[model samples]
Target: MSLEQSSIRDAAIKAPGRRSPAANAPSLESLVSTARALVPRLRERGQQTEIERRVSEETNQLFHRAGFFRLMQPARYGGYEYGFTALLDVISEIGRGCTSSAWACSLGTIHQWLLGLFPAQAQDDVWGKNPRAIMCGSYSPITAAEAVDGGYLIRGKWRFASNVDNSPWAVLGVQLPEENGAGFLLAPRCDWSIEDDWHVAGQAGTGSKTVVIDKPTFVPGHRKLTFAEAASGAPPGAAVNPNPLYSIPFLSAIPVCLVAPLLGTAQGAIDAFVELCENRVTRGGIGGAGARLGQFAHVQSRLADAAAAVDAARLVLDRDITDVELTAAQGRRVSVETRIRNRRGHAYAAKLSHSAVQALFSCVGGSSLALDQPVQRMWRDANAIAQHITLNWDAVSTMVGQHMLGLEPKGAY
Candidate 1:
């Protein structure tokens, strides 16, 4: 490693997750209760969110009032500083109502955790004036950055920035012209022009439109986070924030955060399918009149399969996050082996969740294909989520296999 790179890594590891003066934060139980209470409303608004191609303002306000976005934020900044699993649970529950809404919420809220990785001044630039501030991101290195006097001149367009509509600022992944590694550049919302181009078959409510920075914008040095540093399992922010939450491997956490909504999507499918099966009777069948579809062997078997898949997926995901959190609590960095394993496990869980949704969808019958039917929506959302690169089962599985064979795992995990 270069001298600078070595220094960066050393600095990150030395001061990780240091806690600050205790701040009065919301209890996890209350936060969870609020999330549960919002499920029905989210489900009711699912179609509307989809129709609008973004999560509704009303729903956003409800979340803000409920303090849902504060789950992963630093306690020093008026955040709850709750366990990472709590956010996952909240997203999963919300997903049970609307996957698209859950997707937007998860991305929107997780940005708080990401902000904790930036330098203290950068965090201040964001939460100092308004602690309720939320942010969004596009992690692909499509933007260009030129080294300048105070910082770097960044200019480019980034797409698929979920929930950017609800954010005051955004982090765009960029390739630094002077550096060998890629990093993210933080820019205020005013610096970029948003393009309302998001139209998709699934997860449509996420408002993942294009964000364009037409003119070169200067980003200060403190606002940049190198991929190597982020992936190193410690970041510059850890020095000040000192929360185990920020010490989790950035790559590993990425997949985990994205997978929660998919799990909830599958669970929602199961819920809808079971309700349909219980209420609907076969028009004419071998069992005779008044025979419910729930009694059918096919329906029973499919439900069993779907439920099992979701259960297994949740177990895998929960275990991965728990292990990561435990390592951070111990002030230890997660090994590359463990990081790859967790990434692979997360993708596999997502694949399982997708399978569960597919299974439930297949058994939901013809009428459930209607646009308003929750089952159909879950199916579409699940498939769309499965398409994310972090949750690509085939690629992640191969990477895990290569690692098992004593070969260095390939690709950006």
Candidate 2:
């Protein structure tokens, strides 16, 4: 589809479930089932999404209809009040079909959950009346915010604001200069403007542009959430929401969003490779193509290994989410070791996903290299996701090793 046509369609597509007056929302299981059912249709639109350089309007509508956005939203504003597992599950399902759509949705949906860590007034302003309002963010300390009388004046630009085109709000990580020392802070979307700067080789549909805030506006005191406060497990919404899910460490849950889509993309590659192998015929050989492909013990072994890796990644993610929810339910803080393990598992999953795609690419032969081939797209998408800093294999492995050996670890956890 043409860019103009896609934009027009996006404008016409109304946002779904904008703070429904009715009470009692559907269960997270029901939401997951619905998302799973939509996978085939979403997969069918993969080419369109890649071509448009963003998720198609129809796919976005389907996700909205499934209440996918509310999986991590606050309950007071008509959200499911579900835990982290639901978010991971939804992203996994979507990623298995279209990596770009899955990537965009995962970033957008998780941003909503992270927004809850901000001040209560900021939460109310964004979701008090519109629970469906999506948000995008850049956690890197790339911007600056000045402390004014009632609020902070933010001025800076954040690159790779994923799903910015589809989101109405954003949170830019900033460094605020104080009399004693500099501190980290979060500034709302209203305080910034978006710059169209995303141009990449893969996951092009995410529309992860650069967000520019050249003295755009001011953020109220209530909306400013400090990085120190977040790390200490204290957020402005704690008094109002009072849900343990809100208390889990942010670093633990955020990386899952980055890795889950890659897992799904790997699954897509496996699926495509399997389908191609089934109908393929060997050229200039006595045996049929399928027979030849199947006859190679090495090929069979790699396929099994790839499948195992994908399943193992999915299992680790689900288990980690469950553990996080359980810790939250107990009203206890997650251990530093546990958090590191979660990151380790996610990074391991990313590595396995990359390995799976590489295996599939090797077995699928020269035909898989075509630009239009599904396997080729999945391969590119998986590799791209694996390159994410959050999924950096070496860093994560070193962190995990440190934790196992009782050494001090760096960064937020």
Candidate 3:
């Protein structure tokens, strides 16, 4: 028998038919409120988080205790199984305070939701010991794997694994040699090593460093999640978990996740700019010395444009989220046409957000260039997030255009 098939048999032999407890659902409103309350702490820690190139351990624990990690987890595993939109709401709230904090929090918890789409055995493997276990990942398939007795022995280095230091489990993307396709393997913290390589101008606090697997690490079959399965939103665990929340296509859902932080970061930039304009008097400019920057017609026009752009992005995001949720609840697969539309919307939202942040940053003048300025930080973070491959406007726009022209869209989305 093939090694993959044998691994499946072995897992079946030891499969634990665990039953989850009754749902302890948390209201979305309460979660949003809790997230909003943490903005002050998040903002206070922003500089420190950036200096350390990671969210503080204290802040990580605080978020854990607040049940933020359980927002999308399975009910049996102590997760609230909140709707998909709940993540956007909470992440955006925290993001208004600090983009990196929101990025780490959002990525970490979203992995919990991703775990819900794995086989029940994989779910039980991680959550059995600690239901609130946080997960980190680098989903690009840069690793090499060899078929072994019961699984694959994988060796490679994965970069851009955000929040790796704060996580006990990682989902490493791999290229399946035999199948000539991609899959993700779940590895415990002990199987891999972390390399401190996250150095960047924006979102530096994300601690998105390299996760190295130098030795051949064994990954069992039950722990493997195929790209095709994830893209289809019909993972094995969905059959057992029976939740519509897990049914959303991974690509459609993930593009939105990438844009959520950018949305909030843009809003943060706007808020900071508005406050500065209200209080700071320009030394000399078109508005003249001793005049509040807010009083200038130029400033007013730019602010209005930025505000409108931000509002438009949020509206687009909200509409996509609602559509995905309704489609999932109806137990219908998201059509390729809809997925393409979502990809376009997600990337366009980032474009709008980046434009808004840039507009506000331009008027903030030389003082905004200071590292300590919140508006500048927001500007940097917004641009950085927009550059992410998932949300890059040019790439996504081309993909949508390709689909519209009856050409196979390039890339996984």
TM-score of each model, in listed order:
0.92, 0.88, 0.93
Model 2: residue 274 alpha-carbon error in angstroms:
1.7
Clashes of 2: 2
lDDT of 1 by residue, 1-413 (tens): 55754554344333222222236766556666777788788888888889999887788888888887887788888887765567777788888999988888888788888888888999999999999988888989976789999899987889999987888899889997767779988888889989999999998999999988888888998899888878776799989888777878788766767899999889888888888987987766344457787987878999999999987787666666766776888878888878888888889999999999888778666788888888998898999999998899888888899989999888776
**lDDT value, residue 194 of candidate 1:** 91
TM-score, cand. 3 vs. native: 0.93
The C-alpha lDDT values of all candidates are: 0.82, 0.73, 0.83
Q: Any idea how many clashes model 1 has?
A: 3
Greater-TM-score candidate between 1 and 2: 1
Structure candidate 1, residue pairs in collision: 17-242, 17-243, 18-242
Per-residue lDDT tens digits of candidate 2, residues 179-222? 33333344555666778766678887777788887764677777
- Once fitted onto the true fold, the runs of candidate 3 whose alpha carbons sit more than 4 angstroms away are 1-22, 285-287
- The candidate that wins on lDDT is 3
Candidate 3 lDDT over residue span 179-267, tens digit each:
88998889999899999999999999999999998878899988988888888868887887787778788888776667878888888
Q: How accurate is candidate 3 locally (lDDT)?
A: 0.83
Q: Model 2 misses residue 16 by how many Å? A: 26
